[model samples]
Target chain A: MKKPIIITAALCLTGVILMGVLSGKDVEPGIVAKLKAKYSVKHAPSADHAGFEALKKKFTSPRQVTEACISCHNKRHKEVMRSSHWNWEREEYVEGRGVVYLGKKNAINNFCVSTPGNEGSCAKCHIGYGLDARGKGYTDQNNVDCLICHDNSETYAKAPDKAGAPEAALDLNAIAQSVGRPKRTNCGVCHFFGGGGNNVKHGDLEKALFEPDRDLDVHMASSGSNLQCVDCHTTKEHNISGKIYSLASMNQERSSCEQCHTAAPHGDSVLNEHTLKVACQTCHIPSYAKANATKMSWDWSTAGKLKDGKPYIEEDSMGNHAYMSIKGSFVWQKNVKPDYVWFNGTASHYLRGDKIEDTEKPLVLNPLHGSYADEDSKIIPVKIHTGNQPYDPVNKILIQPKLFSEKKGEGAYWKDFNWEAASRAGMKAAGLPFSGKVGFIKTAMYWPLNHMVAPKEASVKCGECHARSGGRLAGLNDFYMPGRDYSAAVEFVGKWLLLLSLFGVLAHGAGRILSARKHRNGENK
Target chain B: MKNIKEVLIYSGFERFWHWAQAGLILFLAFTGFEIHGAYSFLGFGDAVRYHNIAAYLLIVLIAFAIFWHLTTGEWRQYIPTTKNIAAQLEYYVFGIFRNAPHPTKKTALCKLNPLQKLTYFSLKVFLLPATLASGLLYMFYRYPEGGTTGSLTIETLRTTAVIHTACAFALAAFLITHLYLITTGKTVTANLKAMLTGFEDLEGTECEPEAEK
Candidate 1:
């Protein structure tokens, strides 16, 4: 009777499992087509600029191309003028400091120091033309380089040292006529090559992302979604959304993965619950700098060590610059695991003239603020770039060393190779007093990784962060995590209790067996 | 041998509950320890999923068993007594080895000895409840987004986890001792057979009906 019951139970169990498997495989018709229709790039321009009478004229200067663009779009120059890209500074209410205008103008970084003294070379990436130390170019509507962002020709190149002017060799009239919506090439030109070279600044962004595969970037994959920057960084009146925390202070106008994929995107309830405290990129973007090496460290103090008194570059086995006499020694890495941190979007910057209080630990250039107890805080992955930059020992402030110059003997660190002269010139340009004593202070900059999101299958496994030893979240100990955390005392007592019980049971059983054998032997006798 | 006779010590339902609960507890322990990262056998995700399912099943089993015990008035079997408790302890500790007679006689009316009653009572009342409650809390507790100061919410999983893990160890120890004690019956497999078939050999005692009030 029990044999038939057991067999029936096993059969029922198998039937339930098979039903579950078959149901999981069930998909709605046209689901793949629907997803493709929602995500595929369809950014063809509404109007052809080549047919426009305004753009047909021969343009000499990029400013003339701006004029042609303005004649048609008329009021767009005003919108661009009011943008942070045009002004290079925005009014922000920092936590400790009250309302203050902060941007690349006043903010100091460990790489290329600050933009004050090197405006001519640095402004090549700036949207406007003819930017100077005085920043008077902000008032000039004609200085806005429209073709750099809108040109479909993809041939519009900026002059290396012409204060944000177009390259002399470029056909401005053709580029002006070919103008269309901005593409990945437009943004990657400057953003991908930040900190003087490719993949040197933002570890997650680089030239490799121009035509990424699905494995490298699910959203921007050329064969997949093919999403452009503006798809997610939607703009209104020239003010772009999605601010980088390295430069941004306020939490306003930020883009998130939740903007498209809702907060509870995961099918699993437990995984969905994790979204309350964990950012999507923390798991999705498991490793960054997948295709190219990114700069991890730069020791500026080691600069000026020329190989035979001439600025020369030294390359490692991977051909990445290991040392440059003009800059310093650098440490580059690829496929790096990001350090996790609690971030709440809002950040505070170490301004150009801000005094350094703690010299023992590396100064955080832009401190991303959040804690476990904070309401808006979530665990986010960040690429921390560490370096040693020159500072004023007596003034207790970081020095904005003059890093670029056209002519020699202008106190440019690259040209003159003199820290004292570079600090003096750079500080003078920034309107700060130099104490004439230059010191290198270790500094760290946190760049939150947001792009190059891998496919869901490539995301971090539960064991990676939930394991007891060497977990990915081992650094974050502010809160208790299951599997990774337990009471040591309870564990010790519990282990011993189980061990002693087993020992006692074994000993008692052995005694019983021995006594039983002796009784059997006595009966035999 | 004083006329050994067959007696019903456990009802069919009672035996079913015992073995089902035993299977569930062993399965729970295996999955629970895996989820605690003791050793990765069934993977962490599967371990957690199976553990939670087993927990819900165990809770249902407990409810049914509770209802059965109350309706049958079989709950009186666990009313611990000091009578013959020391003698029972002595028999197990030393007398069993010398081939001495048993201290407490097993009958249908009173199936458990004093020491077994005390151990079973404490386990059913305290250890099991504490383990289940703490496990439930650990599974359900989630910090409110943006923070909360409500009494229902806990700031961390530390307390719930420690209690659950400690109870797990104690229960594991109980399982080892219980398995060994089953062999100490009239025969090596007597208790096992009785639990399976609902009958055991009892000598010098009236083999009353198991349901007799």
Candidate 2:
């Protein structure tokens, strides 16, 4: 009885001590509540975060990022103001389907929103702060204010770190030594769009940026590299043309690869320059075969095949399906075989002196671009009859013409004999290089050629080009050669590799079945 | 064996041109891919630098290769033909599968299979030439004797870009096939050995004592 009483007393004492230590009397929650109420965040925040929120406070000056420019270059400001950039604000709120207006005063941005006091990161691209704090109806027209670019007015103020930049003329505190132009980052921020969703138009935003592993975005944001957005994205009227495709474009097909490769394994005049611009993937990708691939495969066991791994082919659709300009669901790169193909054939150079006689049928010699083999070439037309689209009789093109050539003969030429040349020629004349959109993808948009088979769910758009079942059945395993047998070579190659290692193990096992010497020598086949 | 004047497969300048060209191409491919983020090999910056260096070097090498091939009459070697190609093809497809005799026998005088001859011909004359010309067009989009942007048509440039990309893919596929084919030599290492030592260990009894290198 005495022990129990003593234990209870001890426990009570321990609890009292614990409660004293755990009490919130020292935390000052009241002050925290006030802070939470005011800033809607935790207390003791970094000054920067507080400053960012302070942007909502009423500002007396309209001359921060916008007004500063009006003092000198009012014309440019008015022009920019008329543009779509100012109409984009992120302050749009959607609560239980509140009256959603889609334009002018409340236009929902097609992509990103740029608003103040909103955590919308997109605002950084086109936002302009007047005094940080915005009042009741502070038209963000003040956003994307003029001083950001040509700071003739001192309204735009870059940070101290950017001191080297010339001060805006509108800035009342202008410094004399300012001459910073819009750098690539200022443009790419929205172009790469935080590096996803939408990249810079017409070109890859960070084409070849360095140190991809580390957080180089900071450097991208602030490095102020001498590189300008215009360096690669040469100016166009409304729409800028990439240097390669435009008349002003300068890259020479031959020189371009060599510029980086440092050598010409295939030699000059190796590729045809006429009827096309020289870009590598144009020939490499062939066409998009993803949707049309009959037997999508992960295992290379069947390098190219139908679902059952059978060397079969679908019969062409019967509805008098004329070869329309946009032949639906046709694959590219027909006449595929396992062992021998055009790549194994001869080699030749075509230019002023070493010219090839133009032919109708494409030669099916080994066509691996001369990476292997020790043979000179003979000219033969490479034949092809695969791709989602066929020649357009009206315009004589593989695809419908937009702004340029209008003759039906202006596109991919097809007689159902040879396609590679036709495809190359047509693509050269019609297909948009990297533009893979359906109508825009002048090149074939089938599969297993340019790209792998799209995921099962993604390949449902065959009707976009192909005729229901007929197109599927006709080209099922059209890839299989008519009369070539590659099974032996395949088995031979793999078995030979395996045989090398098995030799030793087999030697020991052979001793039990027969003489080791017999197994080693065997009957000379 | 009838004595053939050790006719140069490549000139001194040509060999230098060839190796330099090959080296730069490999380097460019490696670096360019890294830049594409296909697979990080060298760090991004290093890859870009390496790619740029190789690209410039390739330009130099290509110029030399063009000059060498032009001067040496070696360019004639790429003349394409369809002669006996049908038979040679049969051997690669059906006959090869049956272990039948190869229709196109290899000799110093006739070193390539019919199919090989045709392929090399097309690559040199068509595919690769197209690729090179387009590549140059891409590089010079920035600076040239009198370069300007917006000069090339988007249609033209886009087509060229695709062609270039396609050529790269073809080259990659060829590389893969070549790697596999290297193992198909008489003794697996036979072809590689020939390339390295400039001699091959003849297989079977067809080895005329005089043919032994």
Candidate 3:
């Protein structure tokens, strides 16, 4: 009896809510599961292909779409022409792909530099909407023309709206034939698909959409919130004419993030007096959006093996891109110095200096969390030695990260029994030894050195950052001492080095002087 | 008093060794700071060169001083004692300001107060010994298994740097403490005078022969 009464009460409440919604009132959601169901397409665009055949059905060529796009967006077309995108397919005369059509013999693309025509179409992703796909017909018709997008086939006609070829939206009978896939699905078509032509850029296109506990595998399309193209795209800025800057517009900064995120994106205290400069992209990786990037790894011990007996790639339940991060670990042993570290991989679209060019020779990058780890199954050790910070790994020298930052330099070499033993003997033989804390004396930055800021992006480039041999982004500043210099053990090293050099120089100099005098005496005799 | 001058303020070799060792130690410190890239002195590279020379000179001077001290029985001056050691420490720390009488009086036969004995002894036995040994170890430091270390490990030579630095600061702190103690003498110039003239006048009559303590 109680159950029936409660059911009735719930039904009545739902009715009121439904009535309010019908009358245009905002409805508040309750923590209720009203038999929610999920839907998936039985089949999908190729993991190998981006369903470009559907695009081919709509437009004659990518060039036609470009032309239509230019017609609608005159101003944007001019800007696009100047952008890195326009330079994507470099054109020249007398090539087979050129208007005159020479054979496949003379194309100048990076992949097949001497091939013609289709080579332009093939390597189309080298620039521009290329960030979306190698050539997602962002070029073909030369107009922003696609049957799947904007229902262009309905409004702009196959043969210019003749009486016989009426648009499907207008004809009830043809509506069934023309009604196509939704807008969100079309957006994913490019967002998920990797690039093609010579270099396979972007990444694989057909990844599962809902990867719970794992990092998202989408590009400019990532967010904790499920967003439509217009949510971030906000206004249709008229600079692009009737074309309306949307997916095809490449140069626009995504001001949409500022609408919600309020965090100042940089390391704390990133300013000197009188400077209002900063960048958001310096630290935030595009696809790897989780707070910590280590979420995407797995315990290989339990994972099953592949046919080649290699472990099968398991999806990361956490956001860590173990595939990328493992390849980025740097260990400077006796000789290891890498040129660069690429924090992301084919999936990371906006991280500029991910490719840490030439730092690690025979650069080994495999697909774990996008880091530098060894092949097969070997562990590597990385010592996080801040160039100025010190620690004692032995005796009473507690080497915690906090110790280096705390005290001035007290525990730096306090437990280095070897150093203690060595310095003790020296002091016994000489005068006295002192002990104290050591700390960073005065550290400043050469702003344009290791980092750069352009409002939205920070370019932390290699070679550009680390610079020449022995030079550094964060150069050795002064040191603060609270105890013995060796308490921090940082200051004593140089004097010893100097003393050693002096002894060698003096020893040789004295020997030479004595030998010269002996020679003179022998001659006199 | 007439024969006091003939006892020799300090033996000729002892005086020479003291001045030379002090000069070399000071030179080592001056050049050490410049070499540490703290501030430019003789330029960075040259500072390193000079610091090395000074450090080696100190080592040699110290070597000679040790032999002299042992042979002439001067090493006994540094032998430590616990009698009145606590009182001597208190005299230097708190009593010195109050003008309280010293707990352990100094004399030609027993020059070091108990506190001074402990401190100076530690400098020699622990601090100074550690520094010298570390210096020698650092100078001779090289991988017995020669050839460049593989690219993934830190150089053993770098360890020397850390050890040497540890001792340098220890020595520096001692110098600062020593300077402060020097000022604690009866007059600002009194301790300096004793080392220079080897005579301390008493606050009592001329028969006492000490006008400063």
Candidate 4:
């Protein structure tokens, strides 16, 4: 009794000690301190600097404001002219296809089609003044719209089709006077509203980032790290790092978690080993569109359906647009789990004049290229935005349809509600042939999910990827995972061995018991 | 009744704890296999829910059993001994069919044979703890703050799952052998009746005092 009591007390004490050790405070603040030291720049020239005082003069056009600003910061416009954001064109060598010129300029995407004829609506996100390269030459010094990014007043609003000029009554002098470092609100003005509305293009980026709490994004959390967009996407001479796979040019520096944290950030060595095959975003960003619903799928075939001879709009259960007569039927989802894919940072786009070989499968407008065999490839999360768009039946190529118009009778699909006229005009403007035979073809575009990182405590659980069925990585047979992947032959042999052993034990025990019983009975007799 | 004697082999608390643990183990196995997608009688979600509840109940039962064993000094019964273990093995293998006598005698102070002591001790000390620890880790993998447990990657989670499953298989094997051994008592119903009534039929002679030591 005394021994048992002592042993029980020892066991309880051991458990208490183990708990205390495991709950000890962390000692490594080295990485966070290093990141803060390296990139934290002085809040870009405060408003009282002489550069802002010179901007107190009257300004009419955005170009006039740029000319005055360049008088003091002369090299700013030259730096802006070299970026892809200024030219709207990118050239890169894809694996199967030789060197190809691809960008929003000529590449056909599922959303908003090509930018050739739709530059007025698309160029609203462009940093420079004018629509595409038509209004101002690439070398034009006055075309650099500095206030678009530097405006702290947040009142500078650019109207579509006005040659990158703000609204009629807006105070350009106030915007010029308040120019300073850009904030999350500054970059989000155009990026968050991409693809015609909020949470449309990149499911991970939206208006919620403006004042996000820690749950939505730990880095951009108002009460946490509170990092700005440019913190990780560092810039040199107006050239920003971390271009998307669809827009990246050759020899560009890609932004990664290694910029702030070491490659092996986890304390556990086994977990650190997975960094080679898994992207940080795959685990960090558990889901996208946490703050709002994003468009998942669109069926353009359902568009142009009018109610009582007028365009109509219908809302789904979540109050997201289910159908719009001008656009199409859309399926919206919130807190969406991302699809996993292998990416090697290189992407191939289906540019205009590219042939459609397989009409049976949805046309891949922009396909990220990678495989498990590639050392450069890692399992990354992506959001697949699927839709149907107009294509030429006889020409066997996708046709861009003009969707928006400043006025009626301009062959815009929304105004005329005619696919044929819109296709002909859009194709003519894009310098592509139209066969007068139009049909809707299924198409898909992949958008990489790299934002809306949840706090580290909400990462995916073990069974989510390791279970035999209904696991996240169930069908990914390229790489071997222990619990998830097993050999049937090995299992069969193991089962047989267990069965044989059990049989031997049963037979031997039965023989011993029976013979003993017989001998005892004989002795008694 | 017929030159037979009955002795108190298992206490009432011991019998109750044994049966409760056995029932809980069976339920856990059923639900665990369903969650593993072996047969899927219950849907994945429902199987997970049932498995978690059964696991919690088993944990509570184990805690109570440990307390009872410590306070009553019954924990000493499972301390392993090599004495007569070879003889016990020989009896199972060859001597039993010849009507040879049992190598070791049972008493209230020494309730388990040498082989039972070792197997039960290992199950209690190693296999059961492994299963429970891995299971709890998997249950609370994600923290309330936002991410998973500190430094726990998906690979760590996968490794934990493998450990839990391997321990479960070991437990199943042990249970099967235990069930078969129960029928090998002096009479087929002797062991079952003892577990149910706390009294077991034994040979006419009293147990040796040295056997308890």
Candidate 5:
């Protein structure tokens, strides 16, 4: 009795001691500590430098501000002139083909089709000035619109018809006086409002980033790190480091998390090992369009609808525009989970003159090139924007229809609602021969999502990738994952072993019990 | 008249460890299967929590059991020997029904037969340790993101899970056989009563307690 009491006391004492020790263990500092330490020290450039005080007042046009900026900066305009933003053309070496000129000016996108015959409205986002009706602005150094990027004042507004120039009555002197490092507002003016509306072109970028909550974007959170555009996209001599998805290249120095964070940012080496094959955004961002819904699909066949002699507009359950006679039918989605793809940071575009191989399938306007065999490739999250656009069936090439009018006499599709006239005017301006046979074809554009990183704790859980079904990587069979992958032979053998063991145990136990009962009966006799 | 006598076979601590370990293993197996998506009795989140708690409790029970075995000299009961091994097998398979006597005599110091000695030895030295180590590795695989704590660098938990589950099946097999064999003793309730009372009934007066080896 005494020994039993002692044993019970000992066991209880050990349990209590172990529990106390486990409960007293201290937790380690998390990733936020590392981020806070890294970005805490920064040197912000002074906005009010004495050099800008001597500039001439009463500027009548944006050109005057550019001339003043070049007077002191000297080589600023020359550098801007050499950039693709100034020329609106990028010389790219396509696989199997020689060097091809591709950019917003030459590339035919499904959204707004092309920029050739609609320069006045399309060039509203252009960094240069006076991009004529023919889409030519490369000749003048004074065309560098400095105030568009450098203006700290929020009042600087550009007129769409003025060809990237500020409004006529706007105070250019006050805009020039408030020149400073570019803010999110300045960059968002074009990027956020791309494709004719907010959150249309890029699902990851939106106006909400100006003062985003932590849940929307951890880096640009107003209550947290509050990183600016230029922080990761480090620039030198006015040349930005990052490139759009249409112009990505492995050889170029692209903006990546590795700019500030190391390759192995996580403390767990297991997760760090994933960095070599999986992109940081694949797990961190999880989803895109957190604050606002973005355009998912567009069907141009539904266009030309008119109600009461005017363009009809339809709204979805969320009050988002579902259909517009001017733009056709659209599907909008919010908190959209991006599709995964292996990207090598290099993209190839189908130029305006390129022949369509398969018109029956959706033409990949800009295809991201990578494969599982590529060592440089990583599984990246991308928003696939699908739409239908006009193409010349006889010429076997895509057509860029003039969507907006430069003047009253111009044959714009929006003004006249005539496809043939618009196609004729657009092809003539682009210096391309059109057979006048027009048809709408399906097209897809890939846009990489790299923003709206959730808090580290909210990253993808283990089961999201390891489960057998409904996992994020369920469709990604390029590589094998543990719990998600299985072998029939191994499973079969395991089941057999378990069943055999149970059978053996049952048979042996029955034999022993029967023998013992027989012996008891014999003893009784 | 048949002579009957009672001898203490299990100490209070030994009985306590045996029952506690059994309860913990059952709980661990139940929770572990739920986590493996074998069933949906407990949700995944709750299954993981319960599995972890049961694993820790099992570890604690094993620790106390090991200490007791070492201190009380009960570890010698599992040192397997080939002596009378064939006789024990033969008796279980055929002779017992013919009113044959047990090939090996039970004593306070040598409570287990040769077969029990081998099975218990393997369970303690191999399967139990394999399950415990694999479970611990899976549990501590992740670390605080910014901390310098060491963690397993494996990309997937498939290998660890396989090893843990295989050991669990082996243990379940052992428990089934053990429960059945307990009924093959002198009476159906005799073995269970001994575990509860720390005393076993023998039909002969010739039995004597063996000296420590």
Candidate 6:
């Protein structure tokens, strides 16, 4: 008895020790502290641009500021000239369609259509000044707007309809003097206010990220790591590393979380294993459009409605635009749960004149190319922005409506509410045929969530995606998930087997009790 | 209790192995089902961690048990035979109601009846091996980069998980019947006491068949 007791105690001790050994050790606090310290370290400018003689002059035009910038940083303009920002397109090898130059210049989006006839307003986000309808001035080195990205003053902003020109009231001299590495403000100014409003295009890239708290974004939080956009999107030769798949087609020069945090950053091996096929953002970004509501759907068919012969705007309870005479009736969502898809970096786009295959279903503007079988693919969170935009039903092609122009009767849809006239002028500009009749076709655009990453504690829990019902990955049913899926036949058979065994044992026990009583009664008789 | 003879049936090491294996299997099943998403008790991360740890311990326990059975020549005790199997089944199904005698008798060398022998044999040879193999595959499904776990890759965990889950159900059913069968001894806890203390009281000294094998 003593030996057995002692052996059991020893076994128990062994189990306790095994638990300690098997639960993997966390990363060393000292190492994490060191990494955090290094991550948050801010860069000090090498030279004071304020003392530079070239920047001390009054700049008459935004183009003169670019001239002043190039006077000293002469070779920098050449690098900027070769960038995708200046060219507005990149030579990409599409999977099925060989080589094609795809970007804002020719790529047709569901929102605002394309940039061909709307370059006056669309080019406000462009890096160069005076980008005309043909995307000219890209060849000129002085057109590179240096202060737009490098402005540390956080006051530089492009005018609404100035063809990528800075606001007229901006003191260009002060802005050029304060120029340094790009901050969150520089990127967020255009990226956050995409699709003509704040938090409209990319649901995750929004105004809240300008000075995010740790709970909103761990990396960019001013009270936390306080990282600048340039820290992660490490730029070289004016070519930023991060690629937005909505406009990008190639797999090259894409920024990834693995660049900073290695692929296996978790202490537990199970989570590290998940990293093999699950993108970090799938779990990290629990929801997007955290601070403000984002545009979810746009119905352009309802755009022509006017109140008392005036193009007026209607707002929802959340103060988001419910209907705007220029754009359309809108659907806005806050704290939006992102849909997920398999993405392998490469993508294909619906170019300017591509014919629609099916008119009933929403046409995918930019289809990310990946599947379960793709080794490089991983499940990523995405915002699928759907719209009912104009298309030529007879030509079987989506129309690129001329959306923005300063003057009326220019065939701009916003100014002149005639879809036929707008479609004709827009197609003529894009060199595509458009029928006189116009129809609204449903369309979808995928914007992969890459920012506004929640803190470690706020990340998606395992149960959220691993449960049987209402799982985040429930739509992705092609593959099997552990907790969420199982063979129905197996479950049915297994359940019956367990139930029968229990019932059989109970019946047997009861029979034994009755048999004993019967035997005792027989003896008494 | 008078005129009853005390005999040692289960050895100390055998009893120790039995209880240890039982404890580990129960723990594994609890954690395994949690991982299968039947319920969430320990949380997924901790459940996976504990399951892997317990599985490793079970493997080690099994290795030691096999060694012990081989060294002590107790391996032959589980060699199944069809002889008297019908009579044993009949006794349980019908004859036991009339307080009938057991068709096969227990002894120190051959303690298990024919039905026990067959059940335990199948558990050790087929069900236990399948469960353990599938569990190990599930654990080491995807190896890290540059890992030398060569030529053992699997495309998916679906088949392995199904096999594992099915085996768990079978084992759980077997456990329920085995527990109830323990009460079918001479007294309610006769077999239980025998397993715990390695000693049991028999009716008569002559009942201890020296020529049982």
Can you tell me which runs of candidate 4 are displaced by over 4 Å? A1-29, A33-53, A132-137, A249-252, A503-525, B1-95, B100-213
TM-score of each: 0.93, 0.30, 0.31, 0.72, 0.77, 0.95
Model 1 clash pairs? A375-B146
Q: On a 0 to 1 TM-score scale, where does candidate 1 land against the true structure? A: 0.93
Q: In candidate 4, residue A517 scores what lDDT?
A: 75
Estimate candidate 3's alpha-carbon lDDT, on a 0 to 1 scale: 0.35
Selected candidate, larger TM-score, 3 vs 6: 6
Ranking by DockQ: 6, 1, 5, 4, 3, 2
Off by over 4 Å in 6: A1-31, B1-4, B145-151, B203-213
* Residue-wise C-alpha lDDT for candidate 1, range B74-96, written one tens digit per residue: 89889888888899999999998
Give model 2's TM-score versus the native structure: 0.30
Per-residue alpha-carbon lDDT of model 6 for A241-339, expressed as tens digits?
Answer: 999988888788989888877766776667777787899999999999898999999899999887887899999999999999988899999999999
Model 5 spans with C-alpha error above 4 angstroms: A1-31, A37-44, A47-53, A91-101, A133-135, A267-269, A370-375, A431-433, A492-525, B1-36, B39-213
DockQ, per-model, please?
0.40, 0.01, 0.03, 0.07, 0.15, 0.52
The model with the greater TM-score, 4 or 6, is: 6
Query: Which candidate number maximizes DockQ?
Result: 6
Q: How many residue-pair clashes does candidate 6 contain?
A: 0
- What's the CA RMSD of model 5 in angstroms? 5.9
Any runs in candidate 3 off by more than 4 Å, and if so which?
A1-470, A473-525, B1-9, B143-159, B198-213
- Runs in model 2 deviating more than 4 A are A1-525, B1-18, B43-46, B94-101, B142-158, B199-213
DockQ of 3: 0.03
Candidate 2 lDDT tens digits, A1-525? 124333544553354335434431322345435433543322332233222322333334434424444444455555554443444321222223332322222221111111222212223344343322132223544454443443322334433212112223333323111213344444443444321222211122332232121122211222322223443344332123232110111212212222322222122121222102222322322223211212111111111233343333343343221222222222222112111122212122110111113223322111223221213211111222222222232233232212112233422221222233333343332232312222211221111121111221232221211222232212322122111112344334544554553553344334333542444456543
TM-score of chain B of each: 0.91, 0.71, 0.80, 0.89, 0.89, 0.91
Pairs of residues at least 3 apart in sequence or in different chains that clash in candidate 5: none
